[model samples]
Target: MEETEAATEKAKDLIRMGVARAALLEPQDKVEVDVVPSALIIGGGIAGMTGALNLANRGFEVTLVEKEEELGGLLRYLHRIYPTQEEASDLVKAKARKIRENGNIEVLTSAIVTQVQGFFGNYDVTVKREGKDIPFKVGVIIVATGAEEFKPVGLYGYNGVNIVTQLELEVMLKAESFTRNNVVMIQCVGARDDNRNYCSRVCCMTALNNALILKERNPKAQIFVLYRDMQTYGTLFEDIYRKAREEGIVFINYSPQRLPTLDKGFVNVFDEFLGEEISLLYDLIVLSTPMIPHPDSGELAKMLKVPIDEYGFFLEAHVKLRPLDFATDGVYLCGSAHWPSTVSESIVQAYGAASRASIPMSKRRVIAEPIASVVDEEKCIGCGLCEMICPFKAIRVEEKPGGRIASTIIASCKGCGVCGAACPQQAITMRHFKDEQLLAEVMALAEGT
Candidate 1:
């Protein structure tokens, strides 16, 4: 800790030789408590809000950070929600109001976490808001930074005026002035395709909801929903599928192997159910697509020392049993960033995440199992191989003034010994998962020294 403060001061000296040493640290190292704190909840979306509310209710001083100016995320943009047809803004506003009123919840809107430098019980969090750096130490972290809406700009010329995504369609519907008579909606544009092959899980229900709205407004309007498969596989959704069909909304089936074609005024698509190619004149086309992860996920994963799956979903510690937890002891994940889920599903996930967060609140302090690694910085070459190999981003190279670079950050280190396997100089080793633990057994088996 002394060396960390010294190195930080020295680096600042380079930029301002005359600035006093007192000004170097920038009030940047905030300890949530004078001692290390128990937890941090990232994002202010549904999952994050739920996690914070739960953890705080259980007696933890929780910090909830949101990158957006507002806390509700996608839910805020929605006017009315499905099945119940309840006003979406009303629900989000209630949560936002609850969070603000809760004394235990520390809300940070338009804030970003620049650094998450510690592990389970001793994480050093650096948050930036309005040019001020606030630092805090916490025992746990909850990653509920939900997903961004997918954009189909290139594949089908979605950038045009009439062409819009499901999110934009929501805005139009909320505006209550859409006079679209021949509205055509296309499905599976950016999802379940060759490049991105996972079903988004909620597009069908969304299309069904909007179709009902169109039917209620302009009775003569022709609303068309074209899709390869309608995956309404959950409770209440199947009922919605029937209601859409009953309301005179036309559903067309198409082979995903082929692409939908559009011209200046006419749209051409192969109607698979009808076993024929057909053309239709339409005023507007809405693309019902699934949510995608934000572009900054890789950077956030690195800062938090977490792993993202091949499909770009953040990999939790366990799939079913620990559905909302990361591989680390004090970190958790939930919502669209994990995968496609409905508004209700997101709310439920937020609630579960909050319940999980309550565990840390019940405890006064956190204790990490002592299987994690430590580094011998004296011999570290700082080549950045072990840095890359540790999927958790636990290894970081820090330059010390008037000395060679050093590698540290014990709090972010997981117990995995893979970093030792990548070291040419053998400078890094997990405390309990030491190389000698395996080496001695191997030597005895080989009958060699």
Candidate 2:
């Protein structure tokens, strides 16, 4: 009888506490958003062009902006694509031709975006062309700026004449001017080291592709490839590696501790597989360097209110779930701007970005969660501290008739309570997390205890 009485009393107390907590809660407000149906694509590379075409075909207007005068990006410098041996120029021409025929895509060559204003789904951008600012509005923005090859300067005595980078070797191969029978190609030139700890992802395949090309050009060519680790992943790349070996191209494994050295007219490297140092005379030396992000990517990331990684590559919202989209809605990224991806990988990401951008445009409306920060305008000093502290760029202080006050873009706010904590005048607070409501719970609990 005593145990039953205690249990019943405990249940009653729990019910009372639940009721008290419910009484302290307040209703949530709705945030209505209307999405625009246009897109702005930066970088007129293969990825940018592919994304523009996909969106255009889906009946959306696209503005394709290119910093250069032409459409093809790094592809223009390549001789042939890997695994398929497709002419790089032919592929570029086909995509550029399709873009030209598409009426929905507005190509802006020799133009650069100088300024970007407004929020997601409604952006007012200013493009600079020939000292003139061209202003336009768009719903979505895609970043497809490609990467640049790292120049292996001072490493292994690299000179443009004899010891050249992979990119330079492509030019010689395309022009059929590479007549060197004794060739030595060094992999991981500027990557996979303490300076750059990430793999270029396409260097191994590039080496294999070029090595096979040289073999095909001259049957008597003797090529030696020195690599830290061969990254020939996937079936197609693996087949290419096998063919290189079948064609009698010798591959030597080297360690970073004992990198290949240039001594006199010969290259000396400690072969890890053979467990011995070997020296070889080379008529031409090819250094396989990694692809690096552009220097001005930071400026563009700031303009779009997006984030970049330590290596200057644009960061996605999530590595697996949201690989092509940014945390900022209506903005997406693809191609080498994100990482060192091959042509096919870049195209796949471009298509994925286009698909993600289409979702908001197709819906035409977005309803954000009501759990956002609320601003007490009367207490606000417009100090602009909240704007500076906000990681999502959700809050902004504007000038009103009386004075400056902070306003929250409820759609963009993640309700992280950062603005509330940083507010000097106690002007910022979350909708569901008010001071009085929190104090009510604490008081109720204290009384029960």
Candidate 3:
């Protein structure tokens, strides 16, 4: 009888604790957003065309805008791709043909995005085309604006004649006009320096590829490659590097502190292995320069409200988790626009970006978290503190009839409680995280009731 009485008392205490904990709960409503099933692609390069075709093939509308008059961005200036030695023009032509045949894709050449407004799921973009404005709305935006080869204008005596960039070498190779038999390829020009301290990532492999090509053209050519480091990453590229060495191509390592000097048709470089300085005679000098961000990337970044890296390349949301996405939803990045990537890498990233964009368009609706912030207009002073402090731009203060008031953009809010902490008036309350509700739970736990 005493044991039964003790059990009944314990059950009553448990029930009382459950009731007290339940009082901490607050109701919340989820935010549902309608999605627009269309995409706006900037830059009609291989990456942009590949992404556009992927979406259009899936029965979604795609508007491809290219600043140039025709398609094939950087690929248009190339002779052949490495590893395969296939003509770069053929790759561009095939992708362009696929884009043309896809009925769902609307290609706009010689166009520039003049204005961008609205938020995710609905973006109003104005394209300037031939002295006219064309406005359209898209569900998502893809930036594939690509990069440019850095011009070593004032470095290495680059005159675009005897001395030229790797890109210029490709042009000469394409035209069959490179008649020079004694060539000196200098790697990392205008890259990995105090001014621009980043590897172009493709320079070393490009040097190897071009050196091998020169060897193929003239079996008797004496080619010397001077580099800081040979960044041949993959086995295939490493094999190419080995093949270049086998073909009697010479590679000399040089230090940045003691750089090679151009003196009267000879490159005087100190060979680290030999511990001696050697003068190599050259009929042509190829400066393997880095790829740099386009000049207009800043304007486009501001228009899209996306972030760029220190080097002006597009920054992804998270490098590991969300590599192809921006912090802002409905936007994606790919290709050399993010960094200097090869043809194969760019194509792979293009497909990944297209897949990420398909999620929202396929769903047709996005559900926002219920635990968003709420503003009490009665207590809000509208000092714009929340607006200024918000990292995600989820809150805004606007003029009302009586005074200014703060509002929360539910879809964009991550419910971080930052606004609540910064608000001076205590007008902002993060739903489900109110002070009283939290205190009640604390009190109940402390009291053990």
What does the lDDT come to for candidate 3? 0.90
Q: Estimate, for each residue in 1-449, the C-alpha lDDT of model 1 and write its tens digit.
A: 36997777666544343232223222222122122445677778877887788777776788899999999888887757988898888888888888899898889899999998755566788999999999988877888888877888786668757888878878788877776889888988889877788888888888888888877888888888888899888678898888888888888888877667998767788998778888878888889877888888878887876788766778888897899888765677888778877777877887777677666546545444445566787778777778777766666667666354436445455567788778898888766445554454444434421
TM-score of 2: 0.94
Q: For candidate 2, what is the total of clashing residue pairs? A: 0
Best by TM-score: 2
The local distance difference test score of each candidate is 0.76, 0.90, 0.90
- Model 2: per-residue lDDT, tens digit, 212-283? 899998889989999989999998788889999999999999999999998888999999989999999999
Which residue runs of candidate 2 sit more than 4 Å off their true CA positions?
1-19
Model 1 poorest ten-residue lDDT run: 25-34
Backbone clash tally (model 3): 0
Show the colliding residue pairs in model 2: none
Off by over 4 Å in 1: 1-38, 372-389, 392-414, 427-449
